[model samples]
Structure formats: structure tokens, C-alpha cells
Target: MSSSSSMNKYWIPHLDIHKKVITQELQFYLGPEATVRSFTRDGEDGFLITTPGACLTDEQIDDICVKSKEMWEKQAAARAAGAATRVLKRPLHQPVVISKAGASESTRRRRESRRSNETRSRRDERRRN
Candidate 1:
């Protein structure tokens, strides 16, 4: 499609079958105000759907296209720079801290201390009785 036509329509990249379905769907959903048409560019197929009450001037279209191109270029440049600086190399393997089987040293000590405390309390209770 020509650049002139693109300015006045919302271009949708799709196959022929999808284009028909999308056109019907848009017509159904948007009512009669929506205009759907097929267009070909460099042998690639797509659809151009016109918005309701959309009347953009030639200058406006040119300005939009220019702005879009500039934004796309900026984004592509930023992506390229990011990719170049990125570090692909990772650590050989994940770091894992494996504890010994059963309880850890600190846990065993705490458990033994608790047991002694319980024994002392029971002995004191027996003496009182």
C-alpha cells in the first residue's frame, strides 16, 4: 500500500482468512461506520480498516509517519546498545548450602537445653508434691 493510504487507515497485518473474519467482526462490533479493505504491500497481504469520522490531513499523516520512524529508530538503537553491553556468561552452577543429615549443631544444642529445663521443672514439681 502507498504511504498516502496508510495515513488514513489503521493497517492490520493478517492472512486472507483472518482479514475476512476481522473485517466481519469489526463491522459487526463497530456498526456501518467502520470501512474494511484489503491491501497488498511487496507481495505481503494485510487489511486496512478505516476509523469512524477519521479525516487527517496529508501534513498530519506525514508528521505522524516521521515521528513513528524516529521513535522506532531510537528504540532499536537502545536495544542494540543494551544487547552489546549485556553479560551472557553466568555462574557455572547455582550456589547451594547443604546442611548435614538430621539436625544442625545449633538446633541439637537448643533441643538438649530444652530437655534439661523440662527435667528440672518436673523434679521441682515432684519435690513440692
Candidate 2:
């Protein structure tokens, strides 16, 4: 018997089917529990995007594919931007006082005193050793 038998054959082609697609797959599955209505409206709900199996027009389907791709690209770029901004080169907290002094007489005196004290401590340690 031919596959297009009267008993099982459909008079209208698959292209005739049209359905409104407003909700996303996440929203669809996240709705009520599985039922016969769910199967008739949306295809199998076994962890898949509900938009694919819907009987939308060819143009609508094509537009959906293009828009979905664009959206995915935008989302990827946003994620990369977020990650880049999140990373920091410097430490978490900044010091309250930077303590940078110009080459004044007091600064010169302090540097000389620090060096003399350091050398004296090192000489004493070396002599003891």
C-alpha cells in the first residue's frame, strides 16, 4: 500500500499548520505540569526549546533562527564584558595615606637617619657573629 493512503494520509500539507508563539521555552516548561494540552500546543517537552517544533510560517521560523543567533551573540559579548570588568589588577582595598614626600630638608634628614640606623644595626650584628 502507498504511504499516502486515505486512512492515514493528511489532506493538507505540514505548511498549513500555524500557531502563535509568544512565550519562550523556559516559560512554557516552567508552567503547569505535563498534560494532553501541552502535547497538542507544544511538542515533546523533554528538555528542549519549545519554539522549534511549533508550526510557524517559514519566514517566521527563519526570522526566529536569525534573531536567536543574534541574541546568543549579544549575550556572549555581555558575559565576556562582565568577566573582563570583574577582574581587578590592584588589591581590593586602597591605603588611606600614600605618604609621598618631596625632597625637602626634613625628608633628606629622615633618609640619612634611616640609613645610619640600618648600617649601625647591621655592623653590630656582623661584629657579634
* For model 1, the run of ten residues with the poorest summed lDDT: 14-23
What would the per-residue lDDT of candidate 1 be over residues 1-129, giving only the tens digit for each residue? 234444346665543234334544565544566677887766777666675546434554444455556666777999999999876576656566777655787887898999999999999999999
Candidate 1: stretches off by over 4 Å = 1-47, 89-129
- My TM-score estimates for the predictions, one after another, are 0.34, 0.31
Deviation from native of the Cα of residue 45 in model 2, angstroms: 7.0
Clashing pairs in 1: none
Off by over 4 Å in 2: 1-54, 87-129
Name the lDDT value of residue 66 in candidate 2.
62
Please state the error at residue 22 of candidate 2 in Å: 6.4
**Relative to the true structure, how large is the alpha-carbon lDDT of every model?**
0.63, 0.45
Q: How much is the lDDT of residue 42 in candidate 2?
A: 40
Candidate 2 lDDT tens digits, 1-129: 222222221121222222222224223432332111122224422221222222334564455456566666777999999998875567666456645566566787999999999999999999999
